[model samples]
Target: MTAPYLIIFDVDGTLIDSQAHIVASMEAAFSGLDLPAPSRAQTLSIVGLSLPVAMLRLAPDHSAEMRADLVEGYKAAFQSLRLSADGAALSPLFEGAMSVLETLQADPRFVLAIATGKSRRGMEHILDQHGLRPYFASVQVADDHPSKPHPAMVKACLFECDVPAARAVVIGDTTYDVEMAKAAGAQAIGVSWGYHSVEDLRQSGADPILRRFGELPAALERIWSLT
Candidate 1:
């Protein structure tokens, strides 16, 4: 049998549509500090980064202390929103996401994994909510690794799964994901439905950019076929 290929997915913008909660929590965090919130685009642009790094980029003019406070505030606000009565609606899986995951889960040639900037608790909540905990053979979160574009998270996931970078692919909706995968010597596939633009994904070296979730399986096959 061929060695099982590792397919590492990024969580927030890629698999889960958490934009509603993400933007609202960012606004609430800024409001709590009497600071103006970042615009929706600005907030979304930093979606794949760790909270601290995201705050720095979004609120660059603010003091480190202020940014630190924003980090805590955002975490609290996001958790609150997650536990709200309509939380499930605030972060639904993208259309066709579940079906594709199910398909991949049944494929013996692939081993699924997660690499994301979300905290372990936050990622866990999402997994539990969507019954996705079993879909991933390995999970790497921001709590344990440096932020994206650093390659640590992807490298860690590859390590834990005992899969070589050449036999793995990273799928996400952001330039950070593309860069991270490239830095780790893994191929990257970008999803257009996520926060980042398709042009950005292309510029960052993602090939076979997927226009929708349904196209993923074919894209994966195409990628591996060329290797």
Candidate 2:
């Protein structure tokens, strides 16, 4: 029998194009708190971080209580948006995302999972909306683990899926994701369509950054072969 391999995806920038909804919700959160909203670049800079971590980075001078309030504000704003017709359309799967997911899930050699900075409720909502819940065997989120670059999420996925680091891979769009994969001793593949630059991903130790979703299979094969 062939050895099993695990492919872990990052939700925000990797599978879902959620930046618009995220940024809008963040702005609303700040507005609700009567605080200044960070610029798009500043907000996107901390895309893969946990809510509190992201908020703290964006407003370092803000007190811990302020950060907690911002977190709740952002969640409320995002939830409100999700109820709207326009916000209901938030996070469409990226081009070719469904294609790759379908193909991989149907293959016997691969076990799929998600490690994301999203709250479990939010992650479940998106997965259910996209009809993607059945595809992933494990779903790791900030509600249960630390933020990206901490390796906790990836380690949890590996443990749940019974996949060794050598046979596990993380595909994401940020430097945080790359660092997490490295810390977990798993191969990292960076997708270019997301927030971070290719140079940043490379600097974070991603090998052969994927320029498009269609390249994912080849990238995985190359990663496995080179190992």
Q: Considering every candidate listed, which one attains the maximal lDDT?
A: 1
**Root-mean-square deviation per candidate:** 1.3, 1.4
The Cα local distance difference test for each model comes to: 0.94, 0.91
Candidate 1, residue 112: the lDDT equals 97
* Candidate 1 lDDT over residue span 99-171, tens digit each: 9999999988899999999999999999999999889999999999999989999898888888899999999
TM-score of each: 0.98, 0.97
Top candidate, metric TM-score: 1
Error at 109, model 2, angstroms: 1.1
lDDT of 2: 0.91
